[model samples]
Target chain A: MNDTDLNDLLHTAGRTDGTDSFDARADLARGRRALARIRRRRVAGGVLGLAVAGVIGTTAVREYAGDDTPTARQEQQSSSGVEAVRLVSQPLDAGSYRFGKVPDGWSVQGENAFRVTIAKDGDPDTHPDSFIGKLVIMLDSNAPAGDEVTHHNGREFWVNSDGGGDHTSISTLTRDGEPAGTILVQFPNDAGWAKLTMLEFLDSVEVLEGAQPSVG
Target chain B: MRATDRDAEFVEFVAEHRPVLMQAARLLTAGDHAQAEDLVQTTLTKLYVQWPKVRRSDNPVGYARRSLTHVFIDEGRRAFRSRERVVAEPPAPDARREEQVADDHELRASVLDALGGLPPRQRAAVVLRHWFDLDVDQTARILNCSTGTVKSQTAKALRHLRASLEPAVTLKEIP
Candidate 1:
């Protein structure tokens, strides 16, 4: 078919114009409840009940905790640069890590690493604890390239690549105020894929080893 | 945080561009409407979460596109465990079939059939370029393919369409 004919066909078959939103109001309301719940649970759980998975999957899942249970340290608080951010859990020791700048007013809902806190404001449980997102940082040798925002298991995510270049220190962070994990992985930039490092972010890990290194 | 009625402006931003988002979703999903909608939901939810970082970008739609691709790829991994595959078929023929569809339905049937035969990336290459009016380089970035692949796919799509459509045009007209 000619270009004109092809254009006509595509225009007809393209998606229709209309707002397909059916959950805007409900999701927002849920988000509000989430924020409120986060505040109540800031000190709800005791460190005594904290349990670290001694052995994780094929990939090692490390746990970091403070000398005590993962507790909220006197971290800075701010509402800037964070929005709708919620904490999942701080299983890792957060106070012991580097989380960029712990913005003002950001609370630690759960203790370190596994604590679930909210930043700016929102529900701490937007996603299930196990299904929730973690801030990931790895070697950026093979990151994916695109300008599109992405999602998975109801979580939104992204990866950036400039060209066929080699680099290091890539970070996959969620705005939620949880103790992050900084894992390692081999990442190779490829078409339609990122050659993931056989590792995950190892940030915000906490263990009661008395002395632990904190990741930002 | 929670998008309020006060956030009507943000809502407007999303509503105004949903059609294009939906179109992109359709291609990303290979035309599965439900999957496309889920992609949209995930993208929007993330957009809401990082609206500050995303809004600062020159193109929020671009942000959404990358995010949608991320989900699709991640789902490519363990998603088969929980969800049944749609078989990820190519586009069905676009011709309006009245159940008694004729074999010689001209270019419409031919084009769609061609689409079905194409590889996923090749089909994306064609739709993103022609339907979305994206340039070769842009299509490549979206598909994460080389520009050469985009050009090659378009060429391949055209040849197949021509072969299928020319034969249909030479057939008898409906009475």
Candidate 2:
């Protein structure tokens, strides 16, 4: 068959019954809800920015005021020496991959043999294949390329930031007796993940035999 | 744009263009109406979030089409991967001897089944190039790939379609 014939077939298959069942009003409602959600996120981000700025300003004022009292010094130490976030020892399963520990408030959303997506507890978008604002883990044959390398638990992990430094991807070689490829995890930079905690989580993953390497 | 004004324009746009968008999405999802609707809803929500940009574009409908296509290509990957199926079994020898003819519904099912079997990018190439009547460069722009890549993908898709549909469809040869 020629192009016209093929096009005809596609049109025929795509044709809907003439009932006009599409609900434009419903779409409008959904759109408004999404817009509200976007606005809320922007507001929350702005608030967080202000809080960080306030902390910096307070620190500078204290330094200029020569407030060297023990209590003030302890408060400054506490503020400057914020504890690094760590993963909890709770087991989580995503398809053939298993995580010995994950950061609090994250759970597996969906997974196939190729990749597993984990998202925060309150993420509105539930689509597993949509990776935005989620953590995606996959196994691939590509060599790990990143700006920094860190050795942890006898494995080397290559770390890189993408999406204009908003996202971070860390790749490391899978352990022996499992898939022979790089296992990579990608997460947003502001998702409250410290570099050491991310490394610990990556070290905890176990790639089973059913795992398959993703293709480009 | 003010909130109420933007919303009015968005509602109007959806009312006018949703049917065409749904048709395009049905083709993209290989006749899966449920998934097609989900794709349309997601696309419309995205367009609504960026309503100012949509209104500024010279062709709002075209912009919506491009967004629908991108959403299909991006988030529909896993769905398409799971939906892939083997080609239908060939007709029996006796039926072939008698020159089997299929009705419109049967032909459409066969075509959609074949289309569903293609890899995602190849299927997108066919839908954009043939179903949407887009030029190679236009398809490449929407697909975010080079024109040479578009030509190669479309060629591969056409080859697959011909091979799969030849036994199912017996159209007259064009001179």
Candidate 3:
């Protein structure tokens, strides 16, 4: 066929001028719900995965220690300085460690050799000026020894709170009394909610087997 | 801005563009109305997810069109069309103008059949080039291929269509 023939055929083919039957109100509502479901599923999957990993890690430790009782681990938590309660967990894949617990909506925003920062996933394009503060978790593996030691559910963690800015807390965690991982938690200024979340996250800190010292 | 306002704006956009997009999808799917509707829905859902980015773009319509093409391409790549399907026969030609109408219906069916017979990429290239009147460079950008690829694919597709259609009826009779 020549150009004219092709054009005529295509014009007839593409002529969908008034054939649309989309229900915008219904579709938009459905789309919004779908997006919400997707986000929820992601969060749920992350939570479930981390929780399972925690239980498996704890079970292995208990089995290695020859502890038979279910409350054996719970008893250990009471002896530690920090209180233990359940929360959602996360793995900063690069750090070779995971957050034992984190507040909802605090997804990993950035990561590097020195740190992995978690913050609310703000709508930057739409809400450019909206203030959504950060909670940074830094990794410092260069130091040979830790200055302070804190215990949580029988796990020893080295505590170093930076007095300089917004109370940045660097806790070097250990598993089986060895340097398992290091983390630095930074709270935003005037962020009382973040401060509370940071404290809770620190209390739930448990070192996993994968802490390698490399900048991401 | 509040999220509701953004949602409303997006809804407005969908209402305005859905007809044309559905038409394009219908053409792309070889006049399969049901598949075309599904394609448009899928495209619109994607657009909804990226509405903020789309709203900020200089050419939202072009972006949506490109997205629709990509969606169609991806689904075609997945080989989902291998599932069994049955296309119903078209209605009989009108009795009053039986001969002319039957000829016309036969021509339309043959045109659609030829278009559908092409491989997905070749079909997409042909539709974007001829149906949308996009230049080789524009079609290349949308198809995420080189201009050379677009030219070759369009040429091949046209050759195939000509082979199927020329002797019996020119493609222009498709109405």
* lDDT (10s digit) by residue, model 3, range B1-175: 4689779988888888888787678667766777778788878877676566466555678868887887787777766352222447544444532344234445455566677777778888888877678788778756744568888888888888877665554444322
Local error of candidate 2 at residue B59 (angstroms): 1.0
The TM-score of candidate 1's chain A against the true chain A comes to: 0.20
Give lDDT: candidate 3, residue B134. Answer: 78
iRMSD of all candidate structures: 9.6, 8.9, 13.7
**Residue B34 error, candidate 1, Å:** 2.1
Superior by DockQ: candidate 2 or candidate 3: 2
Q: How big is the positional error of residue B23 in model 2, measured in Å on the Cα after superposition?
A: 1.2
Candidate 3 Cα misplacement greater than 4 A, ranges: A1-4, A16-20, A45-216, B80-107, B171-175
Q: Across residues B54-115, which tens digit of lDDT does each residue of candidate 2 receive?
A: 67555688778888987887765545564743446754564552344345555666677778
Docking quality band of candidate 2, CAPRI definitions: incorrect
Which pairs clash inside model 3? Answer: A112-A216, A113-A215, A113-A216, A138-A184
